[model samples]
Target chain A: MSIALYFFAGLSAAAALGVLLFRQVLYAALSLLACLLSLAGLYIVMQAEYIAVTQIIIYAGGILVIILFGIMITSRLAGKPMQVSTQYPVIGSLLALLIFCALVLSQPAVTSHTSDFSTNHWQRAGRWLMTEYALAFETTGVLLLICLIGAAVTAIYQRES
Target chain B: MSPVLLYLSFLLFALGVSVVLTKRNAIVVLLGIELILSAAILNAIHFNQQFPDRMDGQLFALFIIVIAVCEAVVGMSIIIRVYRYYQTAVPDQINELNER
Candidate 1:
């Protein structure tokens, strides 16, 4: 399981990098799909099957399709690849490195938990969602609804204009 | 899993950031942003396994996914508008409003 997890992680990371490096928009989008799928795999490895499935369905299936549709409608394919400005590459890379280092160094080492995967994991999560964390869960749902409305309005308003 | 996978995830994330910062195309920059978000999600899940008592990490990942969806929708719409106005999606060429 650990080996598989590592493999999937590496695969995901590579695909993510590919998203950045690919010149074609479609290719970059496809690479994002790969990365998302691998993330789902990682979720499963963490014993979060629910999250894994949601990640696949929501991100890889729904959101990615939306992005691809946007690219299709916008006709970015016909345009030539853009050139990078030579002025800031070195500085940008250095800043990114510094941030990455800071993040890694600042994170405390995770303490290990010995609980094995059991059927009650979902039950516990459900209980928490309904009882203790119900408000937060409902708030997230409301946020999603707002975002959906906002996206729809943006799309429709643009079409009408 | 071994530490290599964790390192790889970090590397991918760094590459994505570089792409977003260096790329001149709006579409490509969005893709890079997506990549960076996924990397963060991956790390969260990885750490979640190390401490299974709390489902907070997984929940956070879920929220990130939702947020990413919203971001893509809005961002793509903006990109489309930019394309319509400028006839190009290149970041450098779309700077007409910023030019003095």
Candidate 2:
């Protein structure tokens, strides 16, 4: 289990690096897909069964598709591979490294690492969502509806104006 | 386990920040945002494992997933509209509306 955990974590980090380094838009998007899948694997190792599946379905499956569409529609077919412009590469990376140092220095110490990846959380999560997080669930539904309507309106509104 | 996972999350978050700052394409920028959110979500899951019975961390992660979805949808739509209007997906090139 520990080995699987480390493997997925390493895979995720590597794929994320690919996303960072890839200059081509399609390649970066594909790298993001790999990163997300490896993240799902990490979630599984961490006993987050629901999140693992959600990460795969929603992030990799759904959001990625939308991003692909955006890429396709926006890009011109001028016989050129779609490449994203890199701006302030050195400064951005330096700032990111500074932020990483801060995060590491401020990280909470890990005292007890639990190996409790055995219990099934599907039923428990469902119960809590319906009861304790009931308001949150309903609000999410409303937010999704609003997002659905809003995205449509915003996207099409510009065409007519 | 906990320390490794937390460090991994931090690494991803930093990478995401760099992606957002360095990339010019709207889709790639959005992807960077997704990476940032996912990193934070991973942290929530890490804590969820710590206090399994409380279930707060997991629940928060779930809500964040929903929020991320909404953000992607809205952001994509805005990107689409911007592309339609300016005929370019690079945010830096959109200078008409900028306060000069």
Candidate 3:
């Protein structure tokens, strides 16, 4: 488990860097896919099976398709492949390095815990969502509905005008 | 809360920051934001494991995923709109909002 965790973590980190450094938008999108998949692996290693499945479904399936559509639409409209220009590369790298150092320095000490991987993690999570987090769950549903309508309206309105 | 996980989260977050700061393409910036959100989700799940009796972190991470999907949809729509109006998706080249 530890070995798999570290391997996924390293893969995720590398893919994230690829997203940052890749020149073409499509390349970055592919890199983002790799990063998200690796993150799902990390979630599994952390024993969060429900979260892992959700990550793969929403991020890799839903969000990535949306992003790819966005890329396709823009590239079609522009009649060329999408390539982003870099701005303040040196300064951005320096700032990122500085923040990373701060984060590393502030990490909490690891505490040992007895391994107890719950097989019914999704069941427990669903119960919590329906009970303790019921209000938030309902709110998220409303929020998603509103966002869906708003996005559709915005896209249509933009195309018209 | 292994040290390796902590370091990995930091590394991913840093890469997200650099992507957001340096990339001119709006879609790529959205990708960077996704990376940052993933890192945050990882931290939440890690701590929740430390207190396994309560699954608050897992639930929170689930809600976050929902919100992130919404965010991506809305953000991409707006970016497409901007690309249509400005004829460019590069943030530096879009100055209509700044134009008086």
Give the Cα-based TM-score of candidate 3 against the true structure: 0.94
Model 1 agreement with the true structure over A27-71: per-residue lDDT tens digits: 878888998898788777767787889888988898788778766
To one decimal, what is the Cα RMSD in angstroms of model 2 from the true structure?
1.7
Give the CA lDDT, 0 to 100, for residue B64 in model 1.
80
lDDT values for all models:
0.73, 0.89, 0.87
RMSD of each: 3.0, 1.7, 1.9
lDDT of 2 by residue, A41-140 (tens): 9888777888889889999999999999988888976667789989999999999999999999999866535645565689888999899999999999
Best by lDDT: 2
Best by TM-score: 2
lDDT of 3 by residue, B61-90 (tens): 998899899989999999988878877777
Candidate 2 steric clashes: 0
Ten-residue region with minimum lDDT total, candidate 1 chain A: A78-87
Query: Which runs in model 3 stand beyond 4 Å of their true positions?
Result: A76-80, A112-114, A157-161, B97-100
Classify candidate 3 by CAPRI docking class.
Answer: medium
Candidate 3 on A44-100: residue-level lDDT in tens? 988888999999999999999999998997885466667888999999999999999
Evaluate candidate 2 and give its CAPRI docking class based on DockQ.
Answer: medium
